[model samples]
Every structure is written in C-alpha cells, then in structure tokens.
Target chain A: GAGVSQTPSNKVTEKGKYVELRCDPISGHTALYWYRQSLGQGPEFLIYFQGTGAADDSGLPNDRFFAVRPEGSVSTLKIQRTERGDSAVYLCASSFGLGADTQYFGPGTRLTVL
Target chain B: TQLLEQSPQFLSIQEGENLTVYCNSSSVFSSLQWYRQEPGEGPVLLVTVVTGGEVKKLKRLTFQFGDARKDSSLHITAAQPGDTGLYLCAGALRSNDYKLSFGAGTTVTVRA
Candidate 1:
C-alpha cells in the first residue's frame, strides 16, 4: 500500500459490546504500532509489534485489549466489553525499522463506546 | 513514568505574529519529534531532533532541542492562519525504542 490504512474510520457501539479496529500498514513495514488518543490528550502507546509477534504489549491497559499482526503487514485491535471510557481515536503507525526511523500514521479510527 | 508536558495548552494569535510552544520532561530522550495535527486528521510529522543542542528549520518553522535532551521547543516565524493546529511532541524512553511518549499537545489558533 502507498500508506498506512485503517478500517472502519468510525465505530459506534454500546457498552459491553466488542469492537475491532483494523490497520493495514505499508508494504514490508516490519514495525507496527497501535495507540489510543482521547480528547485533549496525545496518543498513548497501546502496543507494538516487531514482526508477527508482539514485542511490547506493556502499553495495553488491561486484559480487555488485544492486538495482533499476523503477517507483520496488517494488524487488528480488539476491545472486549467496551465501555464509555473507551471512546477515542485509535491510531496505527508503521515504520521500516524499529528505531530512529520516522513513523507514518493512518487517518485513525474513531471509536465511540456509549 | 516518563511524561512530556507541553505548555500553554491553548494559544491564539493574529496572523503574522510569531509563537513558540515548549515541551518539557524530567527524563532524557534519545530523540524527540514534533507533529502538527488538524481537526479530523491524524498528526503529521514536522521534524525530529535526536542529538542534544540541535536545531533544525523547515521553512518558517524552527525546532530546537535542549542541551540536556529533556526539553524541546517549536518556534514559528510570521505565523499564518494555516499554521493553526494542534502541535504535539513525542519522545522515546530508551535508545531506539519504538514506543513513544507524547505530550498532551498545544493547540494554536492563528487568526486571519
């Protein structure tokens, strides 16, 4: 792909419902990341992938959140039992390398869990 | 926990005026990056400063990294209405770490 692409640009769901946001990173991008940005706040690191496996999932808030990049090119963020506080914009970024390189971000998916 | 704090959470000025936004943190960073975001759009990278005491210029925008690598600033010369947007600062906790810690951001509005 020309750039990082995210799916379901907007998702609205009720509390307790599960939601999944997808990201399609640039071709051959080995590093994928997921972040959450709330109103009036910067993007917070949610998870990071070095390849097909998660190298750093420390940023995940709790067990309810999970992300996976099966092929190292596309990723998915899953939220179980969504809550109102889960409302925010989820951002996906990809870089050619794990360090020192700039990250290209997608348009983001706005999730509103009512 | 490492954190970046941006000052003057909101700034509004008339066109042609100059403005500066600061990002401060207690911990040092291997690299710091600045981004500008508009409403309904993702943040766009403006510049990245890696070494301490480094300065870079992009047209009217100037970025400076502190000597201690714990702070950075973004200065705009002859600001325009187009410069109005949310400015963010992101830093890495460790050398070559992919994870970034970002500041809450500074919102600037330049009146036409």
Candidate 2:
C-alpha cells in the first residue's frame, strides 16, 4: 500500500507571495492534518480535517494560513502573503480515524520564503 | 494549551549504549505518541501509549506512559546506529483528540 505523499517537494517563493502545498492521504483514510516544522524543531500542528470539513484549525498561526480538505481525501495548505518567517517544512499526515490512531506522514514540502 | 517538553534536546552515544529520552507536560492527555524522523523526511510513528502507566515495546525500543498521563519516556536497549534520528513526543488533549501538540524533539546520534 502506498503511504501519504506531498507535492512540490520543494518550493521557493519571495515574501508577500502566495503558495499552496498539496497532500494526498492514504486510501480510505478519513482524517488529514497539516503541520509546519522549523529548523531543529518538532512539527507544529496547523489544521486538521475530518472527512470534508476542518475539525480543528486552532493550531493555524494566523488568518494568513488556511487549509481545505475537499472531497474527503486530498488536502491543500494555503499561505497568503507569505513572510520570511513562514519558511519551513510543511508536513502532511493521515490516520484511519481520530485519537490513538497511528499517523502516517509524507516526505513533506519545504517552503522557502526569501 | 498543552505543551510537551522533551529533555536532553540533543544526545550522542556509541553503538550498544543504552539511552532514555523523557517527555513531560503539566497538562494531562488522553494519549501520547512517539515518532522518529530522519533528515529531509516526515516523522514516522514509533508507538502510542494511551492507558496510564502502560508500557509498550517495539523490538529494542521501549515506551512508557506515566500514571498521571502527563509524561512519557522512551528507552532504547543496546542502541544501534540505525536508531539515530530526531525523536519527538506528541500529545493529544482529552478535549480535542484530533489536535496534537508536539515537543521540540531530541536529536540522537548513535555512532558505530
């Protein structure tokens, strides 16, 4: 079985630009999550979707960050007016259900905002 | 807000050595997960401890959850070079099990 995967393994954009990162979760999985990881730091939660709706977005740093998981399988993390501070590795993961379920991750998309 | 703090942010040891990493938090969680991540890759789940004072083992790795559910520890027995990587602890709050708060992580370097 194939694992979770992310597109645009690497992305470089100038400040104030917009970028979208994509994620493809495992087949039949109903939950998807997005996280941002800075250098030498663990991944920070961003947003999570259960089915087609976002169950939680509290972890999103600000209004500039938004994510959508339409169709209940694929998701996208969108950053508007990106800042230099926004540069980091964007990770996507999925689980079979909810709490206590093992989360499988993707290779991640490294976004560099210069 | 629940915050998980991992101890010994960095560790280096020779192969065959034994090591333990700790994760502590003031807030209690319904479940805790341990993950190992290699450079340029996303984290891979090692184990998940849900019941308080429960212990789970994965080959040479051992995981323990505190009785209060506010802490956990990962211990490696006869560590090997393959065990080297960044170890992270993430906790799921009881109220919001879908949201996971991760620790800063501990980088382990096991030399052959």
Candidate 3:
C-alpha cells in the first residue's frame, strides 16, 4: 500500500516569506498530524486533523502557522511571514484513527529560511 | 507540558556489542512507543508498550516499560550495522490521547 507522501522535499526561502507544505496521507486514513523537527532534536508536534476538522491544534507555535484538510485525506501546512527560527524539517503523519493507532510518517519537507 | 528525557544523546559501538538507551519522564502515560529513524527518512515504529513493567522483544532488541509507566528502556544484544540510527521514545498521556510527547532521541552508530 502507498505510504504518506510530502511534496517539495526541500524548500528554501527568505525570511518573512510565505511557504506551504503539502501532505498526502495513506488512502483511507482519517487522522492527520503535522510536526517540526530541528537539527539533532526530536520532532515537535504542530497540529492535528481528524477528518476535515482540526481536532487538536494546541501544538501550533503561533498564529502564523495554519493548516487545512478540507477533504480529510490531504493536508497543507502554511507559514506566514516565516522567520529564520522556523527553519526545520516539516513532517506529516497519518493513522487509521487516533490514540493507540500506529502513525505512519512521510519523508518530510525540509524548509530553510534564509 | 510533559517532557521526555533520553540518556546518552549519542552512542557508538562495534558490531556484535550490546547497547541500551533510556527514556524517563515525570508524567505517567497510558502507552509508550519506540521508533527508529534514519537520515533523510521519517521514523519507523519499532514497538509499543502499554502495561507497566511489561517487556517485549523483537529479534535482538528488547523494550521495557517502567513499573510506574513514566520511564522505558530499549536494549539491543549483538547489534548489527543495520541498527545504526536515531531511536525515539514517545508517550500518550491518556488512552484516547492522539498527541505524543517525544524524547530528544539517542543517536546510535554501529561500526562494522
């Protein structure tokens, strides 16, 4: 079966610019999540979506970060006025449901704020 | 916020040697999971432990959850070169909590 996939494996942009990262979850997955990983550190939770609505978004660092999954299978993470501090590997994951279900991850999109 | 702390941020061992990585937290969790990640790739699940003081074995690898459910350890016997990667420990606060709190992770290198 096809696993999760992310587009634009790597992206480089200037500070204060905007960038969007896309994620394609595995077919039939009903839950999606976004996380950010800094160099040499573990991934930090960002946001999560159950079906078409965001079920948990407390992990979002600030208002500048937003995500949408209107159709429930695909998600996009948008960053507004990106700062150098936002540079990191953005990872997406999905599961059959939530909770104890195993979450499968994508290769991730490396975002570099220059 | 629940924080997970992993010991020995980095470890290098010769092939056929044994190694252990530990993760601890002040908060109790309903479940804990271990994952292995390689460079340029996403993490892959290794195992999940739900019961306190429980132990699960995978090949030469063993995972143990503390009796208090606030700590866990992963030990590998006779590690091979394929065991080189970053090992991460994550926990869910409740049975229904989808969010996972992860440790900083331990980078392991196995030299052949």
lDDT of 3 at B31: 96
Against the reference, the lDDT scores of all candidates come to 0.93, 0.92, 0.95
Which candidate wins on TM-score?
3
The regions of model 1 sitting more than 4 angstroms off are none
TM-score of 3: 0.98
- The CAPRI-style docking tier of model 1 reads medium
What range of 10 consecutive residues in model 1 chain A has the weakest lDDT sum? A95-104
Candidate 1 steric clashes = 0
For model 3, the interface Cα RMSD in angstroms equals 0.8
**How many pairs of residues collide in model 2?**
0
lDDT of 3 at B49: 98
Which ten residues in a row are the worst by lDDT in model 3 chain B?
A: B1-10
In candidate 1, how many Å is residue B110 off? 1.0
Give the per-residue lDDT digits (tens) of candidate 3, residues B1-112. 4389998899999999999999999999999999999998899999999999999999999999999999999999999999999999999999988888889999999999
Chain A: TM-score in each candidate?
0.97, 0.98, 0.98
Cα-lDDT of candidate 3: 0.95
Tens digits of per-residue lDDT for model 1, A1-114: 698899999999999999999999989889999999999999999998989999999989999999988877789999999989999999999989877678888989999988
After the best TM-score superposition of candidate 2, give how far the Cα of residue B37 lies from its true spot, in angstroms.
0.6
